[model samples]
Target: MMHEILRQSLRWAILVTLITALLSILLHAASATLLRGLPLWGGMVVVLIIILVGVVFDMMGIAAAAARECPFHSMASRKIPGARHSIVIIRKADQFSSFCNDVVGDISGIVSGAAGFAVVVALVVSLDFHEGRWLLETLTIGLISALTVGSKALGKTFSIRFANEIIFRLGKLLFILENRFHIRVFNVKNKKKRKRKRGVLRAPRTD
Candidate 1:
């Protein structure tokens, strides 16, 4: 459980970092353009600080959403054969699914953020706008790229096909464990009966 929690936290961290970096670049460009008279470095630093704060808030929002959407607490409570015995198994499977989702989300965020930042940087370098105008243009391009990439990644990652694969594998493992336990119990009962029958047969022959 500890390992899983740590892994989830790391995934969130990666996502938050990507978002923060992308936003910071865009915000910096905007601020620089709007406050053109100010020194470039100072404006950027201020924007960076604001972006960092936004990142913290974004992370908190994600954490809250994760808690609310946790499959272990929700789906695992549903009826299944031998529900009591299967609770732990179901919860573990849910955890695995959550971990996979987090990993995919983080990767998607990184890819989108990188693409957005690169586009903005390239545009800013190529264009010959005044300081304020350049910043505005850069921010616009960054935001557009971020949205486009993020939407594409989300669609690809959360498809029905991938979801079914994970669910099917988890269900299969749960069924196998349940069957194995019953088989062992049955074998033990048969062994005891065989011992008793053998003793009775030998003793009766003496009688």
Candidate 2:
């Protein structure tokens, strides 16, 4: 078990690092070119949008972790695809939380910071805020940080309150994609599943 845990952890570290690097580069490029062209308010709007995405996913991660197993079983018994996906999320809540909240959320925060800097640069160039340019940049960065943290703090309450419903809805979406488009974002294999497969392989052939 310890060896397996270590192996999984190592894999997660590599995957998350790669994903973070790719996303950071894309976001930084976007900030440099796309956000730089926007007006101060427009850039702030972009920052807010990124913050919203981070907060929403953070809430989703918490909700998935908090959801009970019985509902997933009931939904699965009904042959629901979303419930099936939700079952996997619930089974590996820690990993889900790390992916959604830690990896994605942290990336969003970093990108938003870059966007905020772009906003400041835009303001400094377009507006006559040359007197306290440094101060303006500092305030912009501070405001973005405050909003991001505040939104996540508020989102946590909602996540905890409506965890089951949120997870169920998310499951439905996953179900649709998996059934209709055959797209699978996550297909984690549990130890029990591996054991069952092994048992079948080891059993004497009836035929």
Best by TM-score: 2
Models 1 onward score TM values of 0.29, 0.86
Cα displacement (angstroms), candidate 2, residue 129, comes to: 2.1
**Count of clashing residue pairs in every prediction:** 1, 1
Worst 10 residues of 1 by lDDT: 182-191
Off by over 4 Å in 1: 1-92, 130-207
Candidate 1 C-alpha RMSD relative to the actual structure = 15.3
Per-residue CA lDDT of model 2 for 52-72, tens digit only, reads 989998999989788888877
lDDT, residue 57, model 1: 30
| CA RMSD per model (angstroms) | 15.3, 4.8
